[model samples]
Structures are given as structure tokens and as C-alpha cells.
Target: MKRLLEFLGFLAVLQGVMGLVHEFADWNVGVVGRIGFLDGYEVYASVALLALGGALFAVAESRRSA
Candidate 1:
């Protein structure tokens, strides 16, 4: 469970960074740019993803390694 959370957190952080980079630099990277409904809200979504990733990491840290 700890490992799962850590992996998910890492993926979230990666995607968040990629989304931000894609939006700012127009690099055509990450899933944030491809979603149709998130046309104008990519930045906000990316930020949310970053927050979620942080939260996931925190939760993972608080858990016991079983």
C-alpha cells in the first residue's frame, strides 16, 4: 500500500509538472493538453494535480511500511 501510494504520487507529480511545462512552453506534452473539457483550465488542473501529489506523498509518509 505504501509503495502504491508513492508510485501514484510520483506519477501525479510528473504529470503535473508536464502539464505546467506544456501549458507555459507549448511543448505539446502531458494529458492536460489533450483533454477536451479542460481547454481553458489546464493550468488550474495542473496545479490541482500538484497538490494532490503532495497530499498523496504526505499520506504515504504517515503510513507504516507493511
Candidate 2:
């Protein structure tokens, strides 16, 4: 379970970073247009993913510590 959570967390963080780069770096994540609103998608996604990753990591760490 810990390993799975860690893996999922890492994946989420990686995806979030990709989305952020796509949104802010003038890169297209898909066929989508590049605009502020579009960029916000990346921002929001990154934040959510980072949060999830952090949560998972914390949970795993706490479990191990216990």
C-alpha cells in the first residue's frame, strides 16, 4: 500500500509538472489553445497533484513511523 501510494504520488507530481510546463511554457498539452485560462488549467492541476502527492507521502511516512 505504501509503495502504491508513493508510486501514485510520484506519477501525479510528474503529470502536474508536465501540465504546468505545457500551460506556462508556451507549449501545448494537446490540441488546446494557449491562453491565460488554458494556462490556469496547468496551474490548478499542478497544485492539486502536488497536494495529493504530499498527502500520500505523508501518509506513507507516518505509517512507517508508527
Identify the leading candidate in terms of TM-score.
1
lDDT of 2: 0.68
User: Where does candidate 2 clash, by residue pair?
Assistant: none
Q: Rate the local accuracy (lDDT) of all candidates.
A: 0.96, 0.68
Backbone clash tally (model 1): 0
Residues 1-66 of candidate 2 have per-residue lDDT tens digits of 778878888877776676677767967663223445654465776778778888888877767632
Tell me each candidate's RMSD, in Å, in order.
Answer: 0.5, 4.6
- Show the colliding residue pairs in model 1: none
For residues 1-66, could you state the per-residue lDDT of candidate 1 as single tens digits?
999999999999999999999999989999998999999999999999999999999999999999
Model 2 lDDT-worst window of ten? 30-39
